[model samples]
Target: MGERTKKQKLILGIQHTLAMFGATVLVPALTGLNTSITLFCAGLGTLLFHWVTKKKVPVFLGSSFAFMAGIMAIIGDSRMGDPDFMEKLASVKGALIIAGLVYVLFAGLIKIFGYEKVNKLLPPIVTGPIIIVIGLRLSGTAINSAFYYNGEFSLKSVLVTVVILTVVICVSIFAKGIFNLMPILFAIIAGYLVCLPLGFCDFTAVREAHFLSFMDKDIVAQLLCIPQFKLDAILAIAPIALVTMIEHVGDITTNGAVVGKNFMVDPGVHRTILGDGLATALAGLLGGPANTTYGENTGVLAVTKVYDPSVIRIAAVFAMILGIFGKFGGFITSIPSPVTGGISIVLYGMISAVGVRILINSRLNFGNSRNLLVAAIILVLGIGCDSIPVYGAVTISGLALAAVVGIILAFILPEGDDSVLN
Candidate 1:
């Protein structure tokens, strides 16, 4: 293979960075964690994954949506009566670190049972609905963020958000060449520019911020470091790993389709799974969000048609470099809540849609009593009774509950001799 041209490398780096922009910052903003550390860990995790996979797949790792419910639960629990939310956030951070190790256990399971056997348990029927629920559940939060709560919605905010989302979606779907590939990036830039006229953003902080710094203290200093091993914390966070593992499988499949190679068979799904597990554990140890492949970056690849893996590696390096700059970290934090909430509405909805799509594509006859019962029970229990009390102390919600219920239903539902779909 010949050396990649400078333009190609630059484009690849930009693509990876752009793909991560929304996700990397959103995790820290929501969890009261360090955005810079999150970016550092995300970049480091992606690099580590590529190393384990022999740099075969052009992919970038970012914060996983699977952990959102877990983080929210932890924060809600810790902050119920606590005076300082930061102190509670610190405890949650410690739990996140411990929970990250659950990935290793799942990786081991994959190694022992192989991907095929695991798939039998978490087929698309289960995973798709889970994904869809992940998105749809979060969509409510997005819409709430985009509007006002004064018994009347803010038309200006709504218009700005819609315009921004429209620009992103339209460019992504209709634009050509490089323009088509950078819809998200372009959308963000366009939104920022619009906000400038409306005084929605104040860059004075960015201007005053130091050009270079270590650990991005402005962001990292907010969350106090309280690293301690707690068994319950570990157990509480561990269940979410199941959902993330399933997501990893989908990411590998998507990356393979983009690069035109069967990564599941090449470096092997087992290796990729193990790599993601190790990376997630490492990130959590440092008080960062669990890492997973960025679907937005995958979309970029589909648009750019540049499948070179090295380009993504370059982007990872850029993220690492940016992680050390307090100014850059602060600038990202300054992104208004409405902007994030606006985009999140789309992102979270997409997650839920993926779950629904899985069931639809499965072609399971809903007319069948068993199928209807399983789906109905799983959806209600997963979404409605999300906060089911377990053993008087533990509570499960959203994707975690959905996954557990789905697995149980899959095993309990009687397999009929007559084929309904056929």
Candidate 2:
């Protein structure tokens, strides 16, 4: 590759930012976390990840969907006028902080025992199904939000949602170049425009928001309280690191494949995980969601064929700059639920599809009773069981439950050689 001009670099950076913007903001929008803080953490986390990996890995960190369930479970109904809402939010952050520390702990173990051992504990059959469960668990919520508004069906909401979903599908299938890599952003724009004419949007918050407010009230308010380390919330949310940790490795490997370099061998997987861990911890402290490696940005890397870490850093800086714009945050939060829901349908399905791809790539034989049992148990536990009570208040459920059980089954079950049976 030849040396690029400043203008070229700027455009590339902006393209990368747009690629990540939709999914990053969507997490906070869904989980009732602050959009501004999520953006700031994503940028900060990406920078932190790059620094820890010695600036060798070209990747961006964004709000993770894997933890959205835990977040919602811990901090239910954030819009409700509960006097203790802040306290509940603090507990959620505390749990997320623990989850980040777990990543660091795993990173340390990987450094000592090697990633091979960790892989043995979380093979494709185990990790892949757990991932599928994560997406499926959210499927009902996505559908309900898309088809209804506050438990009632609305024609306007459905119309806007259909338009957004159609735009996302068309862009994903038909758009060319950089635009093809940004279905989510295009869907959001299309949704916003559609909502405007249909009377589905309320722009009051955006109208009242300041153009350039760095120290916004939301940030200030979140900063005032220390994160609460409640045992129940911690137990519910922290164990999810097992699932996302595997995802981090997958993302890094995919990014390396795109860039034609082995990031896992160079900067090392441990360092990358450490970077992700520390970034997520910082986010929890600042009242934001957990951070994970973003595949969207990696897709951009593949399309543009620009593997420069500097370009990714430039995108990170753009994210942080946008985080300070109060109006941008307001506008994002004000998006109609149906539009968000429509985009989520594709997003959630894509997540499950990634898991399916993992299984397909591994070519796991479902005819083998061990493999079938492991996957079936994980699917049922993840989607069917809401929470498994462990103690007085603490419980393990959802993705965390499936992840824990899958690892155990993977260890104990004996693999019998069987042909792939359809």
Candidate 3:
């Protein structure tokens, strides 16, 4: 493609922004993080990633689904009322900052040892189930969100969820062009409309919201506190980087293939990983969700055949602009939990499905006892154990613990003839 005019670039940038919008904001909506901050961090992170990569790769960074379980664990159930909610939230931010550092640590390791050694440590067998666990672990939250209203069972909530899911399923399967990639967005719209008649929708926040405030006062207060670095929370959140780092590799590789550029060799995987780490850490510092390379924008690249880094930068700018609009933030935050819950059902399932795809694509032999043991252990430990106590106040549990155990088992279990299918 030839160089395009500014008008063309601006339009393409908006298209890319649209492509990433639904999923990016959804992370904050689900996690109780600020939507504006998530958008700001995502935009800032993309720009930072581009600068780190010398502007060679065409990529956008957005909120990561991988860290959702870990983040929620750190935040804990506010209803319990043990640690104050803001304190718990501060711990989450602290842990995520450390998690981002874990990525930075891996980036340094990859730069020194090469990606191959790190690759062996987290092979498909270990990672696939871990990814599955990330999704399946959150399934309850999705269910509760779908079925409950004001902490009570509501048939009306169920109806709303069904409408959202039905719309999502239909759009994803039957819609053409960009619409095919936007099932969640369409579902939210449908769900919101359905909710209005049933008195499930709330417009009070939207009505009270300013037209152009950058940050809400409550969010500003949260940012003002020092981030608490609890050892247990750090252990919970940091190990997740092991999984997302591998995901970063896949996303970069996919983007490279789409653009016909060897980004791994040019900007180098280490550089890309560093950019991601910095972006994620920035998010943690700013009280936003962790950042990851967005595959959605790459899909836009494939569809539009526009591979320019500058256009991606333009989209990042647009995202930042959107973040500061107070009315927009209120509108998103006002979306009913059940509506987002319905969207989560599909999204969370897809996370697990991605894990299954990884195993299938690698042709890992489940018939082999070693392979079976590794996967079974990861699935059980990850999903079964809510928290396993380690020391006085610390524990290793969930995906982080599962990943650690799986990696050890992968190394310990001797490879048999049928370890992987031929």
Candidate 4:
């Protein structure tokens, strides 16, 4: 404390904001939630997270990809420009609110029983396959959006998509320093630039967009109000919180590793979980996506070596400022679909790869039929989700079904005792 100048903190604050900027906006961009509302909720959520954690941890809350499937299930391929998009999105908002409560329940359990006791329920095998399903299940939307037109795919769309995708891949694989961390933002820029010359971009919306609107007109009337709850959406979405809670613990542990301070022990894992729940519930209530602690900003802290919570608070303030200005959100909305699609290709694939890493690091033994069976059923249920839903509430087919099955199997399946097989 009292070690750095104000200017240094401000610079570090802006850097933190930039680290989270790309991914924070991507959720709304992908799912038809309001960009400004997402920003507003993210900023507010981060502040609430700090408050709940007693302002000790330096984590930044951002849009959660884990909830993307739930959001899409509720919204059902509707674009933000659609007349009824807001109506559909309201249901998803309700789902996220219920899902947030799941975190609170976990927090209570952790406080009473401790982390290891809770871990008995969700091991790597179960959580890993559930995560893989979340990513793989959403894979088709990434592909379809890459080449999508008014109602059909086209060659021009493919060309634009390939260029942006290639650019993002190169940046992610080869670019140096911070550039490597920001492939999404750069790829979107690359796609927009390519589209300008190829006539894919429509600047009419951007031009006609008001210079300064304070969340007025259609924005306030739709996304800027209180989240409306629906039972159908809550049932559809709340189940996902089960999976993401595992993710939350992983993120907290990772952040602890980076900062060399066991956040799970210090600020306490229960508090962190409660913080996330509060932040997520607040975001959902405001019609934004779920909020989770972002690993991206943790990377920024590792790179910059600035551990001040003040810096992250500064970034939260900056996010709020950007959110309050409606035009910046309008500009984000003006970005073409191909741009978001190109980024999704890399983002979605990386999510699945993370699951693979989890399984690999955990040394999951396929020799145990239990492990194999759990993984197998999860993958089949998740990937086959698309066709399965046509027969029923298909919403249950994806991550939701796989997660339930994996949990039950993990609970009853004797822990791969080789002696039993022998």
In model 3, the runs with Cα more than 4 Å from the true position are 1-35, 50-102, 215-269, 284-319, 389-395
**Pairwise TM-score winner, candidates 2 and 4:** 2
The TM-scores, one per candidate, come to 0.77, 0.76, 0.72, 0.70
Return the TM-score for candidate 1, rounded to 2 decimals. Answer: 0.77
> Residue 397 in candidate 2 has what lDDT?
57
- Candidate 2: clashing residue pairs, number: 0
Q: Residues 1-422, candidate 3, lDDT per residue (tens digit)? A: 35677976787676577557767888877777877778888999999999999999999999988787778776655622344878888888899899889888878988998866755777778877876776687677778888999999999999999998898778767887556645665777898898989998788868977676554566676566578899888887777777677667756755765577768778788999999999998899988889998756555555455789998999899888777786765676677878867766766666566677678877999898999999999999889987665543344556667878898999989979988889
Cα lDDT of model 2 by residue, 122-191, tens digit: 7778867866776687678678878888799888878878897788778768887656655666777788
Model 2 misplaced stretches (Cα beyond 4 Å): 1-35, 54-99, 224-267, 292-315, 419-422
Q: What is the lDDT of candidate 1?
A: 0.66
Question: Between 1 and 2, whose lDDT is larger?
Answer: 2
Per-residue C-alpha lDDT of model 1 across residues 57-148, encoded as one tens digit per residue: 88788887667656666565343234665555565566666555666676677778786776567655465555555555555666876664
Which is better, 1 or 4, measured by lDDT? 4
> What would the per-residue lDDT of candidate 4 be over residues 1-422, giving only the tens digit for each residue?
34767876676676566557667888987887777778888888999899888888888999988777778778877866687787886777777888899899889989998866655766778767766665576567667777886658877778878987787668768887546545555666778888888777776645655554443566565555556688777766787677667667756655655466768777788999999998898888778899998756655554445677887899898787667775654555556766666656655665566667667767777888888898899888767864233222323345556666787888898884551232
